[model samples]
Target: MLRHVLEVLDFLDSPTADGPGTIGILERFLGDLDPSTSELRPLLETQRVVGDRGGTDFVTVTVPGRRGRMADGEAPTLGIIGRLGGIGARPEVVGFVSDGDGAAAALAAAASLLRMWRRGDRLEGDVIVSTHVCPDAPTLAHDPVPFMDSPVDVATMNWYEVRPEMDAVISIDTTKGNHLINHRGIALSPPVKQGYILPLPDDLLRIQEIVTGGPAVTFPLTTQDITPYGNGLRHINSILQPATATDAPVVGLAITSAAVVPGSASGASHEVDIALAARLAVEVAKEFGAGTAVLYDAEEFAKVNDLYGSLAHLQTLDGARDESVLDSMEVN
Candidate 1:
């Protein structure tokens, strides 16, 4: 994991012209792992959706599982999204930035998975890795932490990265800026399937323990956290934004630390910690593709739906029409 992490860091720690956004170089790098198992495509025209925002280069890599994405008897495809604004918060900060951990970790997992496949350990289904590249991304001010602002908005990210072919997704992001999760490794969030906040499955907990060789833990989740962005509401971060555009089951993989680290901070990324997060994504992809890891119990989810009615409304940009009424306003 450490080796793969370093490889990815070295790869993405460069300008977009030479890094992950360049489909040719990235395609060549991935082809080295297993040409049969990896495929890359660069989406240069995505800037149109982002209103011609410069420094935005979107790319998606598909690492074939036992079967391809279109095979008749292929297993479910797993989507691993490196959810971040950019790898380097340039012009605002100096040197390579840790805010890019989401993209770095995501690319690392893709490489490792393909490497595993090359070692004759292919997964059951396909694994798709998608993220954008922008070394000089802008910054935004949020409470408790400052974050790397995206060159393109969240909707554009979902448009290019989130796909209907994905049945499950692991959205990884650097969560060191938040105070709620304090640790040195990774933590999982409850399954955000469709629009409902389903309970975290025990199978995932068991897998976490198995992978970390420690106790399983989860980050606290809220309804607002899972809801779509642009609803005039605050969220922890863009970690869960992928769930908005797809009906697939989604989980957030947070790379945490004991200290409240700002996303814009440089030389703050812990190689070991990022490696752990990447490994978690890799392991989940293996389990999920093999049909051995259940993110949530189907029967239980159905029972909750029957008893409580549909919660899919929460997936909308504006949730619960009555909640939008901010009527009782006064100045003291």
Candidate 2:
């Protein structure tokens, strides 16, 4: 699995990187395995919005589920997004493509799945992968840390990346903004389903423990993190933004580090940790598709919803922007 991750890194770490380039590299590795079963789409809308700011190439790769076969459609479909502003924070960050671990991990997982399929080890459901390629992205300041700013805002990204067919999503991002989860591997966020932030699934924890051979680690996600951005509200990051678009359960697969690493910083990615996250995604796909790994308990969830009315408004869909308050207050 780590070999696959390294292979993806080699492809995305280049300076002349773009969506089609990523697809071309990945296609070389994966195209041989029943090309009809997979589909790849690259988008160029990022440049339209960013213009002189930067260039982003959005690419979506999907492995369709086969009906009646091991890889079938009846099972749940999982969407894994390598959420990031750009793979390279060019000029600003030198050498390797900074801010690209999320994309790399997602691509590695996709490649791994394709390899497994080629070897006759097929999953029960389809797996959808989406991410953008941007070499020269902007850097923005924030409290406690700085971040890699995307050329296009969050709304544009959600429109293109988040889809209705996905029953569940795991938005993978480099979460080193704060000092919350002090580890060098991965952390899972509590499932955000139907705009409600549910408790962390025990099954996912079990999988993490089994995968890492240690205690399961988690990130401290706040209500604002699940809410849609552009509302001028504070958020942990864009890891949970997918939940704002769909009613399906969304989880954050954060690749972390012991120290606070800026998203625009090069040499920040850890191959070992990335491999772990990719493996977790593959494992979750297996369990989720087989109806074994449940993200939320149906009975308990309904009870919570009944106990507390629909808090779906916090998803930022209904909340109107109050910029006057934003102007008065000193937002850091």
Per-candidate TM-score against the hidden true structure: 0.87, 0.88
Writing each residue's lDDT as its tens digit, candidate 2 over 216-239 gives: 999887787888887678888898
RMSD of each: 6.8, 5.6
What lDDT does model 1 reach? Answer: 0.76
Q: What is the Cα-based TM-score of model 2?
A: 0.88
**Stretches of candidate 2 exceeding 4 Å from the true structure:** 33-52, 67-72, 317-332
Error of 2 at 199 (Å): 1.0
lDDT of 2 at 329: 23
Where in model 1 is the C-alpha error above 4 Å? 16-53, 319-332
Query: Worst 10-residue stretch by lDDT in candidate 2?
Result: 323-332
What's the lDDT of the predicted structure labeled candidate 2? 0.76
lDDT of 1 by residue, 64-175 (tens): 6666565544688889899997788777787667778888788777667756655567677888888777787888898898988876778667877898889888999998
In model 2, state the lDDT of residue 117.
59
